[model samples]
Target: MSAELAVVYAALILQDDQIEITSDKLQTLVKAAGIEVEPVWFSLYAKALAGQDLKALLLNVGAPGAGGAAAATGASGAAASTEAAVEEAVEEKEESDDDMGFGLFD
Candidate 1:
């Protein structure tokens, strides 16, 4: 896998195990896995995730129809709205492509 994907997988594992995901933790995981990635990527990942709810973000990611139902409920719903919006946006793009009389590959 790519370094970024490896880092994300490490973070997911840490989260699943109830460990805080941090640059140091990511570094240790990556090193233990025998992957050599640039230190800058770790810093970037840390910065990007700072002050964000990683669990919620992970839960909502790539889950299409369920996001709308989740968001319609309450505070836990807010994060899911992002996912729903993404799904709608993807649908819109696909519809627009159909209207254009050409496949994306064309």
Candidate 2:
């Protein structure tokens, strides 16, 4: 699949945040991205963390809000984490940089 055509979505499940994104709704994206969801596609088995604090959880999960300390810590770690994720994503893509959509000249 072309890197430009891949579609990725991140989901953050928060307590009291009741929102459902059914497969039917996501089907178009999934299809366009050339991805197939397995039969057991959704995760419903993550236990709440107790006493570890939000900062620790964020660092582990690598979520922006979670990594910014329990309240507000430095953004260095979060920035590094984000950089790493972006690098990884770029590496995962098989297309050469030139294959990306943007034209060099209009």
Candidate 3:
């Protein structure tokens, strides 16, 4: 993994453990996992996340109401309507008699 991503993962682990996020903690986790990332990455991530509630923030990152089911239903409905429109267009094109100056017996 990239050094940057390693640092983020370490921070997330710290958050999951309910441990206060700090550079030392982040570095410790990263090193324990056998990953070698620059010290700067740990410090930056720790500082950025110091006063934030990672869990709450993560939990809020999605559609606000009715959750995944609503999103899935909307997507399926749109797909069905689009499929019907495409089928109608194809039928009309097939039924056209013009045939652009070409004929089956030509």
Candidate 4:
């Protein structure tokens, strides 16, 4: 695996075990797994995640908040209207085509 991916896996393992993410811990895990990772990657992830609740972050991934739900609802409404308009246009086209007195068997 790539160095960056190895580092990510190591961080996930540390988080999964409820261990604080630190450069040293990340390095230890990566080494134990026989995966090579850059020194900077471990520190980068550790510092970035410092003082954060990893579990909450993991659980809430891709979960939209109130405003996000509102936006999604608005988008759904717009998509429904657009779909209805397209269907109406298609129905009109089909009706007009049928009135043209044209048939394959003719």
Model 1: per-residue Cα lDDT over 42-98, one tens digit each: 888877876667898877787656666655676656667767988999999999999
Error of 3 at 59 (Å): 1.7
Model 4 segments more than 4 A misplaced: 65-106
> Which regions of candidate 3 fall more than 4 Å away from where they truly are?
62-106
What local lDDT score does residue 17 receive in model 2, on the 0 to 100 scale? 38
* Model 3 poorest 10 in a row by lDDT: 97-106
What residue pairs are clashing in model 1? none
Residue 85 shift from truth in candidate 4, angstroms: 19
lDDT of 2: 0.43
lDDT of 2 at 88: 89
Cα lDDT, all candidates = 0.82, 0.43, 0.82, 0.82
Error of 1 at 20 (Å): 1.8
In the range 42-66, model 4's lDDT, one tens digit per residue, is 8998998898877778777765565
Once superposed on the true structure, which residue ranges of model 1 sit more than 4 Å away at CA? 62-106
After superposition on all CA atoms, how large is the RMSD of candidate 3?
A: 8.2
TM-score preference between candidates 2 and 4, better one: 4
The sequence of per-residue lDDT tens digits that candidate 2 reaches over residues 10-92 is: 12232113334443433444565567654233222112222224344455774444433733645686577668989988775
Clashing pairs in 2: none
